[model samples]
Target: MTKQIEESYQLAKQRYAEIGVDTEQVLADLEKVKLSIHSWQGDDIHGFLFPNQELTGGIGVSGNYPGVATTPDQLSNDLSKALSLIPGKHKVQLHAIYAVTDQPKDLDQLEPSDFKYWVDWAKKEGVGLDMNGTFFSHPMLKDGFTLASPDKEVRDFWIEHGKRSRAIANYFGEELGQQSVNNFWIPDGYKDNPIDKLTPRLRLIDSLDEIIKQPYAEKNTIEAFEGKLFGTGVESYTVGSHEFYANYALTREKLWTIDAGHFHPTEDVSDKFSAFTPFGKGLMLHVSRPVRWDSDHVVILDDALIRMMRSLVRDDLLGQTNIGLDFFDATINRIAAWVIGTRATQKALLMGMLAPIKHLKEVEINHDLTERLMLTEELKSYPFGAVWDEFCVRNNVPVGTEWLKEVQTYEKDVLLKR
Candidate 1:
């Protein structure tokens, strides 16, 4: 199989070189791309902080496929398995609730010390870290509003949590030598059309301003804001619309997150990347799959994903983007979910990187649209999969469905035991 992979890769490389696409450089560049894989998928986001709390704020992780991680060691073990299967060294994204500690601490009172377990693990594994403020599934999420809540106390609780999250992200960066991207996503909105919408947006702006008032070194931690179109309950109006965060990110000089699932079904996030890149600080993409709305299904190598990744590669926006996976589907084996989604994302990126984009762009610039369309359509049938297989082999992971066997073995020997 190894020989077969190398043989196919050699032919594929020759094919790409014929079209002026350097497969070697593409692999090297793709290997440098590190995705921030979300940790909540292993345990459905019911972190150690409040294991019994009912998930709220319109977030849902369906399916009861057994062997959900019940402890820090288990989640870390699951993540380790995932890392081994994935091709490149990547960052692990953690929410505030995933803090590993013996002493109990509320979200508002969380300190960097509480997450020592993760930092230590990251050091041992040689992976980077990213942070998130969990705005859902908390008691303080009063009236389905947090940062934008009319109630002052409710707003205060989340504000403190946000501040603490930044400190933790800074600590992660300091420990791991990578700028921890601290993403803020609040589930604050109204299910029914509100009588007054302006007030909530105003309050949210002020709360966010307060949270980011005390600055940290940009090298240690970068801040971002994510806004959703609508959720299960908040179907009518979401306070943090794309427009809201677009302007906010521009003015505040913060990364604006673009979650693929956070937009209307008809809207494609790929188009916005170019529009935002010229003005905003940068982008943090939550590569996800949405069936009809924000369903948070596992990502697949679909057309939308292809376009988004191609846009990034073609526009040369990779350096200005923080790529991350954000999907939680408990219906399947949790470990397999990570492998499939992450691998699919990598495949999309690989396809994009392999495209003869320079030639295509030149043709377009010369007003040769017909030739541009011809090459692009013909390029789709190229042997990029051979190159992708070689990438996995070089990275020392399974090249194909062979990785599934390892995941199945882990499920039987480790997960089912729980």
Candidate 2:
């Protein structure tokens, strides 16, 4: 090989090693699968989480587990136990704590008793939490989090939870190395009336504002606004539509999240989904498999949006986003559910790695490229799902045949060691 190619190959190996990529072992393992095609070579490619730092890795945890611990102590103990089994490459994803269905008179105020379950849960689990309160089971906010609550008490209650959540995260982060939290599914737009005033929207703004005003808000903590489409007749904050929110009365330094499943989709436009690019800033990513027009959060690489997300991540417009499978599989038990969620994250990591490696292998290349240039004009123009599937097949990774079994083995043999 030429000197330039030899140097590039060595650089790739170094980059892979720095990012904790098991270059020699992975190539060997892929060969053992005995596929006809060769695995891609490691080269002088750069590993990225943001502009400069290389990410060690991340892992994911479920939000909808059954019979989870409720108290702080129980939560702390159980979460630690549960997370001990997962690989450290993924960040913990939470559904956040649910509010009491029928809150008693004295239970009106928000307290640690309700949130301690999650605080201890996160502390012991060694993972961050995804605050998914805007759309869960809160009787008071039946309509939605900030958009639906007509009662002052209800609005106050939501804000209180936001504060409590941040406080717990801040407290835990000082003790731990990382502090992570993201506000997802804010769904604060109108349903029936599209012409509503900015009052309800301001309430949603205040929810995020509460976190920013906190003493530790700016520390290691991230508040990602997850937008979504409301019901059939309802209109809400559409994905890729944050310019209006930025101009709102109570704007702050909040960032946007790209939930793979939440993007607006049609049979025709599914391949061309919008991306989140905040003039090159830290990002929170939501990864899932899309089934049809709606968000099934399926396990298979049914959509190419996953690839689209990886390119943005490679470009340094996003960083350190929590990834979790939001789909509800009625057939699987709780343990099985976690396994499924874990696999989705594993797949996402593999996909993210491919973007830069492919970029580095170009015959003629440019490193100083924008997202539009790198993602569209430079990289393969086809959907990423196809590429991911092709790579798995070529490497004999085995698809659609209970991939979770191999994941379980790897977790036991590799991850649980440390």
Candidate 3:
């Protein structure tokens, strides 16, 4: 650790101590939090399934960055580089389409054997793996629906895919000794107003019931359902809207995934955390930055991000919430994007942990509204950066912007060559 960083941390430690917050314990707790890094960020959601498959199902990558990962090995290597620069133990979230195999297999035919390479790599890196059933960007989804399709044949194909994905996720959990979150999100909606939204929703419910009915150890695989507000073509209505999934998850006692970018631009996901925690079995968060519509921008240390983390901390939902990144930007260095987004998430968590949440809550309970508001505003100016720098140092990662140099060096020597 640098002399200046240590000095700053010591001072911040004393300041937090005065507010009944243990800085050392907070740092220790921060290390325990694992943020799942998304694999799609390295390759702009382009999976190595078949040659020249167009991005379908409301999926879009906005830039033509020169060095996007073109193969499974390259994507894994890029993720490794990003993980090296970030602090804390983390997991890598993968889609069904990222499976590496000698022979081409359709989504319905995918098996755990196809992702043996990923399990081996995660074991070597000492990280966990999460899985997702890719319901988008396939020939079956060209009509802009899956699992909720009116066509019986189309719905059956996606149902089989979801079943296999859960089985693969179960394998991941048993092999890695960590619970694998198998998230289900399908871009099923109408470009214009639909004649009958109720019919599609009923079909979706039936499809999910079948998928979840497949016998797998509940301890190994966690089934999570994600909902969306709107997407590129699905502007008028989204079948799996928040209201639909919230009710479904609560009734079925399943994990509900709340993506930050999946709601209206003005809606606060943090506010929903408390509401959902009371009824749902558990929660999974897809942390992303949304501009206007559901534009997945790289997350930064913004106010919304801070508030979200603070909500988790305040509601004591951090343990129940499975945190994961869900943004992919192809305009800049992909590795850099991963580092920046992951670090920003960690930084936000640190800020929340360092806050005098107990005291703030006590004040609120006592009906001291003015003091609560004052203390909240005052805590914002605390030396959070000092604690964050110390965290990076303790994790043996570069402090401040020092990590940028490493990313730049990597781009020059590694990414630019591609």
Q: Rank the candidates by TM-score, best first.
A: 1, 3, 2
RMSD of each: 0.7, 12.7, 1.0
TM-scores across all candidates? Answer: 0.99, 0.59, 0.98
Give the Cα RMSD of candidate 2: 12.7
Better of 1 and 3 by lDDT: 1
Superposed model 2: Cα runs more than 4 Å off: 1-89, 98-130, 142-151, 197-199, 232-251, 267-275, 278-280, 316-324, 355-418
Compared with the true structure, all predictions reach lDDT values of 0.94, 0.42, 0.91
Which pairs of residues collide in candidate 1?
A: none
If both were scored by lDDT, which would come out higher, candidate 1 or candidate 2? 1
List, residue by residue over 1-418, the lDDT tens digit for candidate 2: 2344345445655655553444445433222211000000000011110112221111112243233333334323333433333334234444334322224322234343444454554565444544443333345444444433556676666666666656544544554456455454544444455554555565555555664576664455656565544332235432213444323311455655545555555522222223333332334454555555343443543335445445544543324333344543323333334444544444544455434444443422654456435544533432333433433444344444345575455445533342
For model 2, state the Cα shift of residue 293 in Å.
4.1
The stretch of ten residues in a row with the least summed lDDT in candidate 3 is: 46-55
Off by over 4 Å in 1: none
